[model samples]
Target: MSQITISNAKKIYHDTPVIENLNVTIPDGTLFTLLGPSGCGKTTLLRMIAGFNSIEGGDFFFGENRINQMEPSKRNIGMVFQNYAIFPHLTVKENVAFGLKQRKLSKQELEERVDKYLKLMQIDQFRDRKPENLSGGQQQRVALARALAISPDVLLMDEPLSNLDAKLRIDMRQAIKEIQKEVGITTVYVTHDQEEAMAISDQIAVMYLGEIQQIGKPKELYHRPSNEFVATFIGRTNMIPAQLLHKDGQAYIRLSDGHMIAYPALNHLEDQDVRISVRPEEFVRSVDGPIQATIKDSTYLGLNTEYIVETGFAGRIQVTEESTLDEDFGPGDIIRLEINAQKMNVFSADGKVNLLEVI
Candidate 1:
């Protein structure tokens, strides 16, 4: 296991900046995810760490060693790509032993390492099968085994499970998580899938347009987002235009709907146009509340029913409730909506100030 530190790293593509003055520290033995939409430089950043791409500016280091000048093979990093990248003609055992062969290991040592990783990944039974004869999940396991057989200090995965079916992806995610924990290798995984990142990462960095918007644990990013982009991108949220009414000693700000919402104040300014971000699961359907809304639509998502409520004061608010949310409100049903004041977040119109910062 090793710690990775990137300081003021920048990258460019044809005069266009891909990463801008980026700085991030991935803790040793932790699974850190770089998450964002496509063209956000996540893959570019991963390539930089893997030594597949050059560092245009700043420094990249693994522990105390400066690795920017190192070759990809010398970086001691295992990479699992989106494509399985398995040899069609080679059996699983041969594929896993490829790296060991590169090091010129003796036959006995090669066989020992190959058998170890195959059993570790639970694909030993497929040792004699070629890539064409294995399932997608089995193929992914073989690819992982091949990467691990190299015994790299850090593992880099670039959307390794993107090619699998949803169910297989889930199973593979669990398998990967277990393997990572068992081996205790520091891992850097890049993916556009928010759920996958949230599921396995010890820390997640939300990137946008070559810049990191926020980096924190999944729950922190979800519950207390630093900006509108992080709040909207991390999970489902109802962003409503609101006016800063006033503040108390506790930094409680009133909204345009004449409701006082208590939250951590980010700035000292009294009056400003603020956008309040409330998660869909934070609203409660009520008979009498500060605001009245009409149910515009409802969606049953098995575990929960999502309500699109059109408020007279606040546009459309998405309210998510468990299937047992007591009462059901169909379309056109006039209902009172209750917002959880403590659980809501407020940000500037540009979505910079975290409401938690003010109070």
Candidate 2:
């Protein structure tokens, strides 16, 4: 099993601790992503796992084999970088065969392996062309093909799709997801793009300020984030300050308009001030709804029409609804809204902990 288990990993630069006490496990053959903003030590952690950076403390293991002191080349891991590091002097086929050649595989076996990934990445027709002759997406495919041709135990991708255009990035990400599933190689993908990570990963570890805030499947992270950062970073949310009141042995949040919404999730804390994390989609537009709002701005984007609305007490918040020809709301238009209490998240006033159970 090529599962990756990191235990109490620590990385320090000079006298500053960049990452400390980080523990995470990547199951075999699953596409796990380390996602966060820039300067958050995600790349640092990825390099540590790749053996390019020294682990100041803790164990880095692939199954049972410890790799902290191992050389990078001997780690049996394939790395694809953001720049698509295919040798420009070599043809596509030659680039795909580079690692196999380094291992001194027989010519027939090398050629067969190269051909397999070349076709798997669907760059076979461009096998004879140099890197410059390929489009950005095609070059990325060449890089992926080259990485997989060696049949490594694990694959590491660091923003491999960041250089491509938005449209091409979407296309290439879908391709990468399908290919990874087909090959079944344990992959650790690093990217700052939350949408890209959500689109492609089987599980994602959301990193923040050198620490992992949450790790779970895409939907789990989105619908039930562990903290305010994950709730705000993974997607857009309106943070409304409210009071958490315990009445009759149940938890509840009171809105500015005196509307109380029940929170069924157990938080084990006493009644106190809390914040509500309501996604734009969680706000329902109802003619007889309790919440009243005035439209500040609106943008129509095909399927969904988004609005910036101001309520009596919640200031300004985003609201989204399906676009319709007859129900278009513009500036100064009054509307009634209701919160989807079942989906909205209640967090502590300090934004450190969610009031609901988080796994």
Evaluated with TM-score, which candidate comes out highest?
Answer: 2
lDDT tens digits, residues 112-198, model 2?
Answer: 898899889999999999999999999999999988888888899999999999999999999999999999999999999999999
Q: How close is candidate 2 to the true structure, as a TM-score?
A: 0.97
| Model 1 CA deviation exceeding 4 Å by range | 247-252, 262-269
How many steric clashes between backbone atoms does each model show? Answer: 6, 0
The candidate 1 region of ten consecutive residues with least summed lDDT is 245-254
lDDT of 1 by residue, 157-220 (tens): 9999999999999999999999999999999999999999999999999999999999999999
Estimated TM-score for each candidate: 0.95, 0.97
Give the C-alpha miss distance for residue 50 in model 1, angstroms: 1.0
RMSD of each: 1.9, 1.4
- Residue 327, candidate 2: Cα error in Å is 1.6
Computed on alpha carbons, the lDDT of every model, listed in order, comes to: 0.88, 0.92
User: Positional deviation of 74 in candidate 1, in angstroms?
Assistant: 0.7
